[model samples]
Target: NAGVIQTPRHKVTGKGQEATLWCEPISGHSAVFWYRQTIVQGLEFLTYFRNQAPIDDSGMPKERFSAQMPNQSHSTLKIQSTQPQDSAVYLCASSLQGGSNERLFFGHGTKLSVL
Candidate 1:
Protein backbone atom coordinates (compact mmCIF):
# COMPACT_ATOMS: atom_id res chain seq x y z
CA ASN A 1 0.00 0.00 0.00
CA ALA A 2 1.33 3.42 -0.93
CA GLY A 3 0.35 6.76 0.50
CA VAL A 4 1.66 10.22 1.24
CA ILE A 5 4.16 10.19 4.12
CA GLN A 6 4.88 13.19 6.37
CA THR A 7 7.76 13.12 8.81
CA PRO A 8 7.94 14.26 12.40
CA ARG A 9 4.35 13.46 13.34
CA HIS A 10 4.76 16.23 15.89
CA LYS A 11 7.27 19.04 16.18
CA VAL A 12 8.00 21.77 18.69
CA THR A 13 9.89 24.93 17.83
CA GLY A 14 10.65 28.11 19.66
CA LYS A 15 9.27 31.44 18.49
CA GLY A 16 12.15 32.56 16.36
CA GLN A 17 13.25 29.15 15.24
CA GLU A 18 12.73 27.38 11.97
CA ALA A 19 10.69 24.28 11.19
CA THR A 20 11.15 22.06 8.19
CA LEU A 21 8.49 19.49 7.36
CA TRP A 22 8.89 16.65 4.94
CA CYS A 23 6.36 14.92 2.75
CA GLU A 24 6.81 11.92 0.51
CA PRO A 25 4.00 11.41 -1.94
CA ILE A 26 2.97 7.97 -3.12
CA SER A 27 5.61 6.52 -5.41
CA GLY A 28 3.73 7.15 -8.64
CA HIS A 29 1.44 10.07 -7.97
CA SER A 30 2.27 13.61 -9.04
CA ALA A 31 1.25 17.28 -8.84
CA VAL A 32 2.11 19.75 -6.05
CA PHE A 33 0.49 19.42 -2.57
CA TRP A 34 0.61 21.28 0.73
CA TYR A 35 -2.05 22.50 3.12
CA ARG A 36 -2.33 23.87 6.64
CA GLN A 37 -5.13 23.21 9.12
CA THR A 38 -5.84 25.26 12.20
CA ILE A 39 -8.81 25.79 14.47
CA VAL A 40 -9.25 29.36 13.30
CA GLN A 41 -8.69 28.92 9.59
CA GLY A 42 -9.80 25.38 8.92
CA LEU A 43 -8.13 23.81 5.87
CA GLU A 44 -6.17 26.15 3.64
CA PHE A 45 -4.26 25.52 0.47
CA LEU A 46 -0.66 26.57 0.76
CA THR A 47 0.72 25.59 -2.59
CA TYR A 48 0.32 23.46 -5.69
CA PHE A 49 2.85 21.50 -7.70
CA ARG A 50 2.89 20.20 -11.22
CA ASN A 51 5.69 18.17 -12.71
CA GLN A 52 7.90 19.00 -9.80
CA ALA A 53 7.30 22.72 -10.22
CA PRO A 54 5.52 25.13 -7.91
CA ILE A 55 2.60 26.75 -9.65
CA ASP A 56 0.60 28.45 -6.94
CA ASP A 57 1.27 29.63 -3.40
CA SER A 58 -1.20 32.44 -3.02
CA GLY A 59 -2.50 31.10 0.25
CA MET A 60 0.92 31.06 1.83
CA PRO A 61 2.25 33.97 3.82
CA LYS A 62 4.39 36.23 1.68
CA GLU A 63 7.17 35.86 4.16
CA ARG A 64 8.55 33.00 6.26
CA PHE A 65 6.66 30.28 4.38
CA SER A 66 7.82 28.36 1.37
CA ALA A 67 7.38 24.95 -0.26
CA GLN A 68 9.26 23.01 -2.82
CA MET A 69 9.02 19.78 -4.80
CA PRO A 70 12.50 18.94 -5.91
CA ASN A 71 11.49 15.68 -7.52
CA GLN A 72 8.64 13.24 -8.05
CA SER A 73 9.13 11.37 -4.78
CA HIS A 74 9.01 14.15 -2.21
CA SER A 75 8.25 17.70 -1.24
CA THR A 76 8.92 20.00 1.70
CA LEU A 77 7.50 22.96 3.58
CA LYS A 78 9.75 25.22 5.59
CA ILE A 79 8.72 27.97 7.96
CA GLN A 80 11.19 30.60 9.11
CA SER A 81 11.00 32.58 12.32
CA THR A 82 8.30 30.35 13.61
CA GLN A 83 5.65 32.01 15.75
CA PRO A 84 2.84 30.71 17.93
CA GLN A 85 0.41 31.53 15.17
CA ASP A 86 2.31 29.23 12.88
CA SER A 87 1.29 26.13 14.81
CA ALA A 88 -1.01 23.85 12.90
CA VAL A 89 -1.44 20.46 11.28
CA TYR A 90 0.52 20.69 8.07
CA LEU A 91 -1.00 18.29 5.58
CA CYS A 92 0.57 16.91 2.41
CA ALA A 93 -1.55 15.50 -0.33
CA SER A 94 -1.19 14.36 -3.94
CA SER A 95 -3.55 13.80 -6.82
CA LEU A 96 -3.50 11.27 -9.64
CA GLN A 97 -3.08 14.34 -11.79
CA GLY A 98 -2.85 18.07 -11.15
CA GLY A 99 -6.21 19.73 -10.87
CA SER A 100 -9.24 20.35 -8.68
CA ASN A 101 -11.15 17.40 -10.12
CA GLU A 102 -8.69 14.72 -9.12
CA ARG A 103 -8.91 12.90 -5.82
CA LEU A 104 -6.32 13.73 -3.17
CA PHE A 105 -4.43 11.26 -1.01
CA PHE A 106 -3.38 12.89 2.27
CA GLY A 107 -0.87 11.99 4.89
CA HIS A 108 -1.85 11.97 8.56
CA GLY A 109 -0.13 15.37 8.87
CA THR A 110 2.72 16.84 10.87
CA LYS A 111 1.49 18.81 13.84
CA LEU A 112 3.71 21.83 14.50
CA SER A 113 3.76 23.53 17.84
CA VAL A 114 5.48 26.83 18.39
CA LEU A 115 6.20 28.34 21.75
Candidate 2:
Protein backbone atom coordinates (compact mmCIF):
# COMPACT_ATOMS: atom_id res chain seq x y z
CA ASN A 1 0.00 0.00 0.00
CA ALA A 2 1.39 3.35 -0.96
CA GLY A 3 -1.08 5.80 -2.43
CA VAL A 4 -4.40 6.31 -4.24
CA ILE A 5 -5.70 3.80 -6.76
CA GLN A 6 -7.69 5.17 -9.73
CA THR A 7 -10.11 2.91 -11.56
CA PRO A 8 -12.81 2.78 -14.31
CA ARG A 9 -10.33 4.28 -16.74
CA HIS A 10 -12.90 7.06 -16.88
CA LYS A 11 -15.26 8.73 -14.45
CA VAL A 12 -17.87 11.45 -14.71
CA THR A 13 -19.56 13.15 -11.81
CA GLY A 14 -21.82 16.12 -11.28
CA LYS A 15 -20.59 19.04 -9.31
CA GLY A 16 -20.68 18.72 -5.52
CA GLN A 17 -20.66 14.93 -5.68
CA GLU A 18 -18.00 12.49 -4.59
CA ALA A 19 -15.37 10.79 -6.72
CA THR A 20 -13.42 7.81 -5.55
CA LEU A 21 -10.56 6.63 -7.71
CA TRP A 22 -8.93 3.24 -7.30
CA CYS A 23 -5.50 1.93 -8.16
CA GLU A 24 -3.93 -1.51 -7.89
CA PRO A 25 -0.20 -1.42 -7.99
CA ILE A 26 1.88 -4.10 -9.58
CA SER A 27 2.41 -7.14 -7.39
CA GLY A 28 5.84 -7.44 -5.81
CA HIS A 29 6.44 -3.76 -6.32
CA SER A 30 7.18 -1.94 -3.14
CA ALA A 31 5.81 1.42 -4.10
CA VAL A 32 2.38 2.65 -5.20
CA PHE A 33 1.83 6.07 -6.71
CA TRP A 34 -0.70 8.73 -7.74
CA TYR A 35 -0.61 11.79 -9.94
CA ARG A 36 -2.95 14.39 -11.37
CA GLN A 37 -2.87 15.86 -14.84
CA THR A 38 -4.45 19.01 -16.18
CA ILE A 39 -3.79 21.23 -19.14
CA VAL A 40 -2.89 24.12 -16.90
CA GLN A 41 -0.47 22.27 -14.66
CA GLY A 42 0.53 19.38 -16.88
CA LEU A 43 1.33 16.49 -14.53
CA GLU A 44 1.58 16.95 -10.80
CA PHE A 45 2.73 14.52 -8.18
CA LEU A 46 0.17 13.79 -5.53
CA THR A 47 1.77 11.04 -3.48
CA TYR A 48 4.23 8.17 -3.53
CA PHE A 49 5.44 5.23 -1.48
CA ARG A 50 8.56 5.36 0.61
CA ASN A 51 9.58 2.45 2.78
CA GLN A 52 6.03 1.12 2.62
CA ALA A 53 4.58 4.46 3.73
CA PRO A 54 3.08 7.36 1.80
CA ILE A 55 4.68 10.77 1.85
CA ASP A 56 4.40 14.22 0.34
CA ASP A 57 0.86 14.96 -0.79
CA SER A 58 1.50 18.65 -1.27
CA GLY A 59 -0.10 18.66 -4.70
CA MET A 60 -3.49 17.60 -3.45
CA PRO A 61 -6.06 20.22 -2.48
CA LYS A 62 -6.07 21.07 1.19
CA GLU A 63 -9.76 20.39 1.35
CA ARG A 64 -11.96 17.76 -0.37
CA PHE A 65 -8.95 15.56 -1.03
CA SER A 66 -7.74 12.40 0.65
CA ALA A 67 -5.73 9.27 -0.11
CA GLN A 68 -5.50 5.96 1.61
CA MET A 69 -3.53 2.75 1.31
CA PRO A 70 -5.47 0.11 3.12
CA ASN A 71 -3.28 -2.77 1.97
CA GLN A 72 -0.23 -3.65 -0.02
CA SER A 73 -2.13 -4.38 -3.21
CA HIS A 74 -4.34 -1.32 -3.59
CA SER A 75 -4.89 2.29 -2.70
CA THR A 76 -7.58 4.91 -3.19
CA LEU A 77 -8.08 8.62 -3.73
CA LYS A 78 -11.32 10.25 -2.76
CA ILE A 79 -12.50 13.70 -3.76
CA GLN A 80 -15.39 15.03 -1.74
CA SER A 81 -17.82 17.49 -3.30
CA THR A 82 -16.22 17.37 -6.67
CA GLN A 83 -15.74 20.59 -8.58
CA PRO A 84 -15.09 21.43 -12.22
CA GLN A 85 -11.61 22.46 -11.29
CA ASP A 86 -11.05 18.93 -10.05
CA SER A 87 -11.56 17.45 -13.49
CA ALA A 88 -8.38 15.78 -14.60
CA VAL A 89 -6.72 12.46 -15.29
CA TYR A 90 -5.74 10.62 -12.15
CA LEU A 91 -2.72 8.41 -12.75
CA CYS A 92 -1.47 5.41 -10.80
CA ALA A 93 1.97 3.93 -10.88
CA SER A 94 4.18 1.38 -9.15
CA SER A 95 7.83 0.67 -8.83
CA LEU A 96 9.94 -2.33 -7.89
CA GLN A 97 11.73 -0.12 -5.45
CA GLY A 98 10.65 3.05 -3.76
CA GLY A 99 12.90 5.89 -4.64
CA SER A 100 13.05 9.06 -6.69
CA ASN A 101 15.21 7.42 -9.36
CA GLU A 102 13.36 4.15 -9.66
CA ARG A 103 11.47 3.36 -12.85
CA LEU A 104 7.69 3.44 -12.67
CA PHE A 105 4.95 1.39 -14.30
CA PHE A 106 2.02 3.71 -15.03
CA GLY A 107 -1.60 2.99 -15.74
CA HIS A 108 -3.54 4.64 -18.58
CA GLY A 109 -5.14 6.74 -15.86
CA THR A 110 -8.71 7.42 -14.80
CA LYS A 111 -10.22 10.45 -16.43
CA LEU A 112 -12.47 12.29 -14.00
CA SER A 113 -14.82 14.98 -15.25
CA VAL A 114 -16.61 17.09 -12.71
CA LEU A 115 -19.47 18.95 -14.28
Candidate 3:
Protein backbone atom coordinates (compact mmCIF):
# COMPACT_ATOMS: atom_id res chain seq x y z
CA ASN A 1 0.00 0.00 0.00
CA ALA A 2 1.07 3.53 -0.61
CA GLY A 3 2.32 5.58 2.33
CA VAL A 4 1.37 9.11 3.23
CA ILE A 5 1.40 11.69 0.44
CA GLN A 6 2.40 15.36 0.81
CA THR A 7 1.85 17.79 -2.01
CA PRO A 8 3.96 20.52 -3.56
CA ARG A 9 7.18 18.74 -2.52
CA HIS A 10 8.66 22.23 -2.23
CA LYS A 11 7.33 25.69 -1.50
CA VAL A 12 8.91 29.09 -1.88
CA THR A 13 7.44 32.02 0.01
CA GLY A 14 8.34 35.64 0.34
CA LYS A 15 8.41 37.25 3.72
CA GLY A 16 4.84 37.62 4.97
CA GLN A 17 3.38 35.42 2.24
CA GLU A 18 1.09 32.55 3.10
CA ALA A 19 2.03 28.95 2.48
CA THR A 20 -0.36 26.05 2.50
CA LEU A 21 0.86 22.46 2.57
CA TRP A 22 -1.21 19.33 2.14
CA CYS A 23 -1.02 15.76 3.30
CA GLU A 24 -3.02 12.65 2.43
CA PRO A 25 -2.63 9.74 4.78
CA ILE A 26 -2.95 6.11 3.89
CA SER A 27 -6.44 4.78 3.53
CA GLY A 28 -8.07 3.50 6.71
CA HIS A 29 -5.64 5.27 8.97
CA SER A 30 -6.81 7.80 11.53
CA ALA A 31 -3.83 9.31 13.27
CA VAL A 32 -2.05 12.15 11.51
CA PHE A 33 0.93 14.07 12.82
CA TRP A 34 2.71 17.19 11.61
CA TYR A 35 6.34 17.89 12.31
CA ARG A 36 8.95 20.47 11.39
CA GLN A 37 12.52 19.34 10.78
CA THR A 38 15.65 21.44 10.60
CA ILE A 39 19.35 21.05 11.31
CA VAL A 40 19.37 23.20 14.44
CA GLN A 41 16.01 22.23 15.83
CA GLY A 42 16.09 18.60 14.82
CA LEU A 43 12.50 17.27 14.60
CA GLU A 44 9.80 19.31 16.20
CA PHE A 45 6.27 17.99 16.64
CA LEU A 46 3.77 20.54 15.42
CA THR A 47 0.45 18.85 16.06
CA TYR A 48 -1.63 15.73 15.59
CA PHE A 49 -5.12 14.45 14.93
CA ARG A 50 -6.91 11.43 16.15
CA ASN A 51 -10.02 10.47 14.25
CA GLN A 52 -10.22 13.86 12.60
CA ALA A 53 -9.98 15.76 15.82
CA PRO A 54 -7.03 17.62 17.27
CA ILE A 55 -5.12 15.70 19.85
CA ASP A 56 -2.26 18.05 20.58
CA ASP A 57 -0.81 21.24 19.15
CA SER A 58 1.60 22.16 21.91
CA GLY A 59 4.48 22.37 19.49
CA MET A 60 2.91 24.72 17.00
CA PRO A 61 4.13 28.28 16.83
CA LYS A 62 1.78 30.41 18.91
CA GLU A 63 0.91 32.75 16.07
CA ARG A 64 1.75 31.79 12.50
CA PHE A 65 1.20 28.05 12.32
CA SER A 66 -1.91 25.95 12.28
CA ALA A 67 -3.07 22.50 11.17
CA GLN A 68 -6.34 20.82 10.41
CA MET A 69 -7.84 17.50 9.44
CA PRO A 70 -11.22 18.12 7.88
CA ASN A 71 -11.83 14.54 6.78
CA GLN A 72 -10.56 11.01 7.01
CA SER A 73 -7.98 10.90 4.26
CA HIS A 74 -6.41 14.33 4.23
CA SER A 75 -5.04 17.21 6.26
CA THR A 76 -3.51 20.62 5.74
CA LEU A 77 -0.96 22.85 7.42
CA LYS A 78 -1.10 26.56 6.90
CA ILE A 79 1.46 29.16 7.81
CA GLN A 80 0.63 32.82 7.77
CA SER A 81 3.12 35.62 7.45
CA THR A 82 5.83 33.17 6.62
CA GLN A 83 9.27 34.25 7.74
CA PRO A 84 12.83 33.22 7.00
CA GLN A 85 12.90 31.38 10.31
CA ASP A 86 9.97 29.32 9.14
CA SER A 87 11.97 27.88 6.29
CA ALA A 88 12.21 24.19 7.06
CA VAL A 89 10.91 20.81 6.03
CA TYR A 90 7.36 20.14 7.08
CA LEU A 91 6.65 16.46 7.39
CA CYS A 92 3.38 14.63 7.80
CA ALA A 93 3.16 11.20 9.33
CA SER A 94 0.25 8.84 9.86
CA SER A 95 -0.54 5.83 11.94
CA LEU A 96 -3.22 3.22 11.60
CA GLN A 97 -4.95 4.65 14.63
CA GLY A 98 -4.43 6.99 17.54
CA GLY A 99 -2.79 5.63 20.63
CA SER A 100 0.27 3.68 21.57
CA ASN A 101 1.60 0.84 19.46
CA GLU A 102 1.03 2.64 16.19
CA ARG A 103 3.96 3.06 13.85
CA LEU A 104 4.31 6.31 11.99
CA PHE A 105 4.59 6.37 8.20
CA PHE A 106 5.91 9.67 6.87
CA GLY A 107 5.31 11.51 3.66
CA HIS A 108 8.09 12.87 1.51
CA GLY A 109 7.42 16.32 3.03
CA THR A 110 7.08 19.87 1.79
CA LYS A 111 10.28 21.86 1.87
CA LEU A 112 9.47 25.50 2.43
CA SER A 113 11.89 28.31 1.72
CA VAL A 114 11.07 31.80 2.85
CA LEU A 115 12.77 34.63 1.12
List the RMSD of every prediction in angstroms: 0.9, 3.3, 0.7
Candidates 2 and 3, the one with greater TM-score: 3
Residue-by-residue lDDT tens digits, candidate 1, 1-115: 6688999999999999999999998877878589999999999999988889888899999999988888898899999999999999999998877867888989999999999
Give one digit per residue, the lDDT tens place, for model 3 in 31-66.
Answer: 999999999999999999999999899999899888
Q: Judge candidate 1 against the unseen true structure and give its global Cα lDDT, from 0 to 1.
A: 0.91
* TM-scores for every predicted model: 0.96, 0.89, 0.97
Q: How accurate is candidate 3 locally (lDDT)?
A: 0.95
Candidate 1 TM-score, C-alpha based: 0.96
- Candidate 2, clashing residue pairs? 1-72, 5-22, 5-23, 5-75, 6-22, 6-23, 7-22
Error of 1 at 57 (Å): 0.8
Cα lDDT tens digits for candidate 2, 12-93: 9999999999888877887877889999999999887654577777877889999888888888899999999999999988
Which candidate wins on TM-score? Answer: 3
Clashes of each: 1, 7, 0
Looking at model 3, residue 16 earns an lDDT score of: 100
For candidate 1, the per-residue lDDT at 99 reads 69
